[model samples]
Target: MTANPVYEFTEREQHILKLLVDHYIEQGTPVGSRTLSRLPGIDISAASVRNVMGDLEHMGLLKSPHTSSGRVPTSAAFRVFVDKLLDVKPPEKGTIEHIRTLLDPSLNDQALVKIASNYLSNFTRMAGMVTVPRREEKPLQQVEFLPLSDQRVLVILIISDDDVQNRIIHVQRNYSKDELAEFARELNEVYLGRPLAEVRDRMRKDLERTREDMGNSMQRMIDVAGQVFGPDEAEDNEDSMLMAGESNLLGHADLGDVSKLRDLFNAFQQKRDIFHLLERCVSADGVQIFIGRESGYDALGECSVVTAPYEINGKLLGVLGVVGPKRMSYAQVIPVVDVTSKLLSAALNMRN
Candidate 1:
């Protein structure tokens, strides 16, 4: 949710302010009082419009660039406009059908997520992003351990009928092939049908309980099981984020500074910060808008982010959004994001 700035404005002041903002957004340049006075519904002289513009500047809602007598809206002004002034309408039926067609339920999870990101970028002409769904732990079907040279053991995991995973663990001492097989057999007997995370916890507790009287072979087996069932960093990376059309931001005049553009692209490449920002929106309801400097990240000080969370069976999977210049058409982008999330959620539910 965007916080609305508290500022009182008379009917004439509000009318001129809206005119100035609309003109500036369309032209990407400062708007002078004469230009606004000539617009429809002004019913005032250029001099009177200039006086109102000066008052708005004093309120911190507008600023005058040194190069021009015209005034442009400040970030504060955009916040007020988005929260109270702007009227949002539903997306066209054609757009909703296009999005629905692109997000086909028959596609795999990765493909579906990629399509969603592309749709956001193509529709809004901005950088689009989507976080991969967090995987749930599945019950183990079988386990195997094979001894290798140089104190290494290969742990094979059968998570389901068709899912198999392999991991390598280094040990303090080399064990014979027969000993490794026996260790795997013992672990499978106790943990074959349990989820991997729960199995790891149970193994740790069993070790704590039997530590005083356990023999060397049993202790070694427990240690091996711990390594085999631990969190896999490589697997976690698979669930990070997918992005498309980042270069579209390059075409935005407000974001043309070379240093700022480089930093923004770097932030996208190193997704930790952006991922954390999107993660905060996972619990938020409906669409969220973050105008310039409101995103709280230096890289996004000149940009706006619109995001919505997508889910299946009412369980949140992740967030999807677009990053663009602050002057973007929120009336269009907001509905696209809102509808895309719903379509993505419906497609995922169908796939499941």
Candidate 2:
């Protein structure tokens, strides 16, 4: 973990390091000097390759797990590989179609976020997550009130793109059907298509003005509408989101240590911290790579997260990514995240 960013690596060192890392990633094994010598363009003998690996180990970029075995790149080495030595490849045609097919435009945002999570997991063979967008920032689309028992009622909220959600609450008294309809009409009249927070603010102003001039019953009804839409404060942009493929992580041998796996599952179960991390990526210009300990979470020390923020116009909607072992194929997963973000963004923008 040399922090100053080693820019002094020579051409030979870079070539050998890239060859070893690529081999280790593809084969999922420690790379010996013998393996390096077999690389297509490499003309060096095993002895020469050993010298390079020993130099890399001394620099703390690689590690020897045993006395005479192969060398494994350290997290520092991975940082160098991803940041400098690696060459990314275009996503395969099937990868693009997987994204397009799963994230269908006909689906709602919620459904597609779930799909994105699953697709990332299935494609990358790791855990995947997409933070739910804060959609309440827009004007409320429609409102309705339905009655069940004498004292119970359902309040429905329709936001952008006809996304409908409902909640039930109990009231002190019962109202007739006509009375309920009148209340619904009044609520729609005042707050229809207005931002929920703005509606709350405007209601406060109107309430103060009408409190003195209107009957107590009308004032009470307005208070009820305020209670209906005011609970969430109009912020749907949440760190809370959907995740699929957590079980997939359990299958990775790198996470086979029962205790660390348990801890990783616990971290995923309590998503607030991970969401905070995802929220940080929303401001990054492109894909953000967190390699192992760089994530600042111990449970994720053996993992890597590739996250990209998706947006509508310039407004960031949410972040999506694949979570896998530190040996994940960056060339493959990067484009998956990058393209999925764009697709998710385009999907959201279509609602406008």
> TM-score: which candidate is best?
1
Candidate 1 residue lDDT tens string, 1-352: 3455699999888888888877887899999989998999889999999999999999999998899989999988888788877889999999999999999998877788899999899989999998876443456789999998899999898864445778789887898989989998998898887766678678767767667688888988877777776543444433578889999998989899999999899988887777878888988999988888777788988889999999877778789999998888888899899999999999988876
Which residue window of length 10 is worst by lDDT in model 2?
230-239
lDDT per model vs. reference: 0.85, 0.80
**lDDT score for residue 5 of model 1:** 65
For residues 126-243, what per-residue lDDT tens digits would candidate 2 score against the true structure? 8999988756455687877777786877888787655677888777677666777888888788778776667767776665674778787687676667567554453333336777
RMSD list, candidates in order: 3.8, 4.2
Number of clashes in every candidate structure? Answer: 0, 2
